[model samples]
Each structure stands twice: as C-alpha cells, then as structure tokens.
Target: MTMKIVKTLFLKAPPEHVWKFLTEADQLALWFHRGAADLKEGGDWTLVTNTYGKEGEKMCWGKVLEMKKPERLVHTFTHNHLKGVETTCTWTLEAVKGGTILTLVHDGWEKYEDDPFGMAANHDSGWDEHFGRLRRVAS
Candidate 1:
C-alpha cells in the first residue's frame, strides 16, 4: 500500500481565505479543532478540542515543517491519543477559476508496528469529518 491518506477538496474560497482556516488558531476552530497557536514554519503546534472529555485536551501535535503562503504547507504530525507514532501532513492549495483546489497527503504510517492500515482507516474518516466542516465554513 502507499500508506497515505490522500484527499482533495474544492473550496469556494480563495487561497488566502483557506490559508487562514489552516493556520490561524481562531479560524481553525471554526472548522477543525482549535489550534493552540497559529501555525508557522519551524514552530510547534497542537490541535485541541473541548468536546470529548476535558477542555483543551490535545488531539494532535506536530511541528510545522514548511510553508509557502497560499500555496503549500508541510508538517510533522501525530495524534496524541495514538502515542508513539509520528506522521506527516502536507497541504497544497491551487487557485482555480472560482476558488481553490486543496489537497491533503497524510503519510508515514510505515512507522506503526501494530496496525498501520487500521490507523490509516480511522484517520481517513477523521479527516473527512473535518473537511466536511471546512467546506461548510469556507463556503
């Protein structure tokens, strides 16, 4: 298997608008989990949610690896709940006729000694949930 969860979405918003939802703490919470802080290259980040149990409990944590404004972003990521495994999340945004084409490539499941495929399946569903929210908010 390729060991990656790849998804592409068409957002009815400009690249700049989509960028904020991905990087800004407040903007992120509008769609995905609330970010601990704005994401920037070379900086650490954590996504937390107050819904499941305790408030501000971390869902994911990672370091921003690379970013090229309104275009590309790459980060080292890991779900805190699935400890001992780290992966990478890469996002690419391309301007289109009416909006932006956003692509996500989440990989690095090769590190999972126990159940890589199962984890990939769970994450695939998780991303779909977030993406659905993003589409609605960004519209």
Candidate 2:
C-alpha cells in the first residue's frame, strides 16, 4: 500500500472561509458530519454519521494534534468501533485563482494492506465524495 493518499479540491471561497468550515466543528457538521469537536491542540474530535446509527453510535473518532488556522491541520483518526488501526490526516490550504485550493493528504495506511493499492482505492472513492460535498458547501 502507498504511504499516503492525496485529495485536492478547488473551492469557491478564500482560504479563510473554507478553513472555517473545515476547522470549526459547527461548520463542519453542516457539511462533513455531525459531532461535537473542540478546536485546539490536543482537543477531541468525533464524527457521527446519521445514516449509520444513533448519535452515540457513529464512527470517526480522533484527536487534534495541530491546529494552525487557515493553513494546516493535523489529526490522528480512527473509527470509533474499529480497533488496532489509526491514521494521520493532514489538510493543507493554499490561495488560488479566486478561491482556495485544498489538498488533504492522509498518510499511514500501509500497515493494514494485504494487497497493494487496497487502502488507496477505498480512500480514493471516499475522498472523491467528500471533496464534492465540500465544493457544494463552498459554493
């Protein structure tokens, strides 16, 4: 498996605005998923999907490792119900044309792969949907 996966998106807003929706848990719940998130170094972050189960039964639990606003965010991510695996997720923002170009790189997926590109393929599709959702939110 590759060590990293990159997903890029061209949003219709500036880095500052996009970063708000990306970093702030309230704004994030509007587009990404629902959960209470504390925006701080070493803060808690949990992502809940309504399609899955009750409020307390959702997945995507993690902690914020770095919280540099509007430019970079690094976090450790793991599914709430899944054990023995965790990944580092980083979001990088850059100024572009009339908006922001966001690149999300998720590294550390190599350990669970029994076949090459297995994790990459799974993440590729997931990111594609997520980027599309983010674009719609930005627009």
Candidate 3:
C-alpha cells in the first residue's frame, strides 16, 4: 500500500509571497534549505544542507512536474536517505481572508514498502519541523 503525508498551515502572507519562499533560492534559505528552483514545468530544483546529518552537505533534488504560479506546484522528489526511492510532492496555496492556506502532500511511499510506516513517520516529523520554520519565515 502507498503512504502519504499531508500537512496544511495558514501563513500570514499572500499566495504570491508564499510562492516566492518556495521558488526563490534566497527566500527559501530563510526557512527551508539553501537551494535553487527553476520554477517551470519540467525544470530542476535542488535543496542542499549540512544540518540533517554528519559533517558534509546532503542534497535533495527533483524536477518540477507542474507549476501554477501562486496556486499550485507539483514535483518529483528524492533525497539521500530515501535509498534511491523517488516520490512526488505537491503544494497547494489558497487565498484566505487573513492570508494563504498552504497544503503540502508527499506521496509514493509504496516504493519503500519494506518499511513504509517507519519512513512515513520520519518524514512526517521532518515536514512538521520545517513547516514550523516556514511559518515563522512566511509571517
């Protein structure tokens, strides 16, 4: 069975502003990781960091599968810890009364069926921690 992680948060910013945080390397570094995103369909994106483990930097990369500006984005994602497994991440932004409601979904854990739940749990917490930082940055 496939597993997925979904997270949603209300950011005290417009969708356009939140889009910048996700697409621009400098803005992304303030909360997520230092990285560059091509921001077009089929384009490439990479996020690199030294904070997760050991001394050297680790990298996560993917291709932009879809882009709808300040509305939605879908990408294929893979990281070192994923053990060559690839997944997909989708971000949806909705304009609300006070700000933007951001929803994130990461799917395709069936590929890691050997330990699906364990891997999902790890990523759940990781996304939570990162979203907390994103909240602060987007606010």
Candidate 4:
C-alpha cells in the first residue's frame, strides 16, 4: 500500500489570501515553518523551524516542482525524519462561496517497509496542527 497523508481544510479567506500563506515567507512563518527563501518553481524549498528539533534549523528541504499562485503547488519534500527518502507534496486551492478549500496530498511512500499507518499518522497530525494555525490567521 502506498503511504500517504491527505488533508482538506476550509479557510474563511479567498484563494488569493490563502495562497499568500502557502508561498510567501513572512506569511508562512506566521502559520507554518519559516521559509528559507522565496518559494518559486525550480528553486530551493526550505522551511526552518525553531521548535521541532533544533533551534532555527531546516525542518525540510527540497526543490519546488510547480507553483501556480492561488491555485496549486507541487514540491519535492525531504527531511531528516524521512531517513533520506523523498516524497512529493501537492497543494491544491479551490475558490468557494466564501472561502478557499486547501487540499494537501503528501505521498510517494509505496515502499517504506515499516508500519505505514504509524508513519502517515504522525505527519497527518502535524499537518492538522499547522492547518489550525493557518485557519486562525487566514480568517
């Protein structure tokens, strides 16, 4: 089975507003980890954290695959926690009646010989926590 973590969140803000939180460094720092540089397609995608493990250290680093403002983003993701294995994260934004629907699909784990549920569950919880903060500020 392919191990993956998918989450759908409804934010009380338009796609334009929600997109900023997903791409811009300043806006990302307010909800998620600190962006190491401007997020652009084909550029380095680095997110640093002060609380995860080390202080002011990169939590994840990879290359940005695709970035369509206010619509979608795809990136290669890897961190120390993944034991050097890389994955892909795709964020899709949909404009709704009064807000945006942000869906995150973190996949590419079809051969992780360990307990998939445990692994996916951990990341799933982490995403929920991040989304909680995103909701507060985006609204």
Candidate 5:
C-alpha cells in the first residue's frame, strides 16, 4: 500500500502572500510553529511544535528538495517520534479568482509498514488544524 495524506484548501490571499507564510520564520510561527529555514533547494528547516502539552516541544526537521516561489515546494520531513523515518511533503499553490488553492501531499508512509503509532492520522489532523490557522492568518 502506498500511504499518503493529501489536503487542499483555498486561502483568501494571493500566492505570493501565501508563500511568505509558508517560508518565513515569523510568519510560519504565527500559524504553524516556531522555526526557521533557508527555503532553497537542499536548505535545512526545522519546526518546533508546542501544541502537545506535557509532551513538551516536538521538533521536526527537513531539507528542501524543490522550491518554486509562489508555486510549489517539495521537502523531506521527519520527526523524533518517527525515530528518523523520512517522508516527502509537497505543497502546490495555484492562483484563483478569489484566492490561492493550496494542495499538500505527504507521502511515503509505506516505508513504515504497519504504522503501529498512527503518525499519519495524527499528521492529517495536525495539518487540518494548522491550515485553519493559516487561513485566518492569510485573510
């Protein structure tokens, strides 16, 4: 089974504006997490999430595999809970009449086999919540 998590949402902003929220450290922290990144191909990035109380902060690190300003980005993602397991995340943005359509694809879970910890589901819900915040920030 090829496991993947996909989500799409329309934001009330142009692709350029939305791109900043995805790439800039301060802007990302407002909607997603506290972290910084170079945002270029092969650049390293990190995000520290404080949303899970008692579990403290969880750090996710990745390297940018591809980047096209205001259009698309592909990166390798991994976190502590996954014990160095790596996956790919792609984000594509399209301009529309009212806003930009953002599509996110997080794939490569088949590498984890049975996924006894359900990390994919946790990330699915996490993206949903973060996207909601992203919408508000972009509005």
Candidate 6:
C-alpha cells in the first residue's frame, strides 16, 4: 500500500473566485502559509510554514508546470525537510450544484508503494488540514 493521490473537494464559491484564491499570493498565505510564486510555466514557488514545526523553516518549494485558469493547475511539490521525493500536485475546478467544486490531487506516491500505511497516514491528515483551511477561506 502506498500513496495514491488523495482527492478532496470543497464547495463554497464559484470557480472563478476559488481560482483567484488559489493563484493570488496574499490569499494563499492567509489560509495555508506564507509563500510566493512567479506562477508561470516553469516558474518557482516557495512556501514557508513557520507553524510546521521547528523554529522557522521555508520548507516546501516547487515549480509551476501548468496553469489553466479556473479549470486546472499542475505543479511540482517538494518538501525541503523530506528528501528524495517529489509529487505532482493538481487542482481542478468544476461547476456543481451550489458553487464550484475544487478538487486537489497529489500524484506520484506509487514509487513508495511498499510503505503504503505511512504514505496514506501522512497525506490523509495533511490534506484534511490543508483542505479544511481552504474551505474556510473560500467560504
């Protein structure tokens, strides 16, 4: 058992609004963590989560591979604290009943298939917290 990209949805606002929150720098830091990105293809992103344990660490960094407006976004995810692993994270927005359904998926865990439990547990909780934060902010 290994990490299969976790996908979760949050329905609160329109796709355009949700897209703005995801792309904007200030809104992202408000709910998730303080970070910045050039936000273009092959551009870079930096996320510094001081609350992610230890004193202060600019832990996660990645490159933007694709950005398709309110429809989809694909990016590379890397944690400075975690070695030898990289994940491709994608965000897809779809129209739904009351509002937009935002789907966040992190693929590329199959490489660690032998350690399924740890991967599952790690991502399960992480997505819960992060998606919860996104819901609160998107609402």
Which is the leading candidate under lDDT? 1
lDDT of 3 by residue, 26-109 (tens): 787888788754366788888877475642354888889999999999998888778888889999999998899999999998
Give Cα-based local distance difference scores for all models.
0.91, 0.77, 0.86, 0.86, 0.84, 0.74
Query: How are the candidates ranked when ordered by lDDT, highest leading?
Result: 1, 3, 4, 5, 2, 6
Per-candidate TM-scores read 0.95, 0.85, 0.90, 0.91, 0.89, 0.82
lDDT of 4 by residue, 41-131 (tens): 8898889886856767888888889998889999988888777777899999999999999999999765444655776788788889998
- True-structure Cα RMSD, model 6: 2.7
RMSD of 4: 1.8
lDDT of 1 at 80: 60
Clashing pairs in 3: none
Clashing pairs in model 2?
A: none
**What is the Å distance of residue 41 in model 5 from its true position?**
2.1
Indicate whether candidate 2 or candidate 6 has the larger TM-score. 2
| Best by the TM-score measure | 1
With a 3 Å backbone cut-off (N, CA, C), the pairs that clash in candidate 5 are none
Give one digit per residue, the lDDT tens place, for model 6 in 12-108: 7889888877767667776676665536667888776657355346667788889988899888886743465677889999978788977778877
Over 1-139, each residue of candidate 5 has an lDDT whose tens digit, in order, gives 6778999989989999999988887788888887655466778988876566723354888999999998999999888777778999999999999899999999877676557338788888899999899989986
Candidate 1 local lDDT, 12-120, one digit each (tens): 9999999999999999999888999999899999999769667798888999999999999999888764675889999999999899999999998878768889988
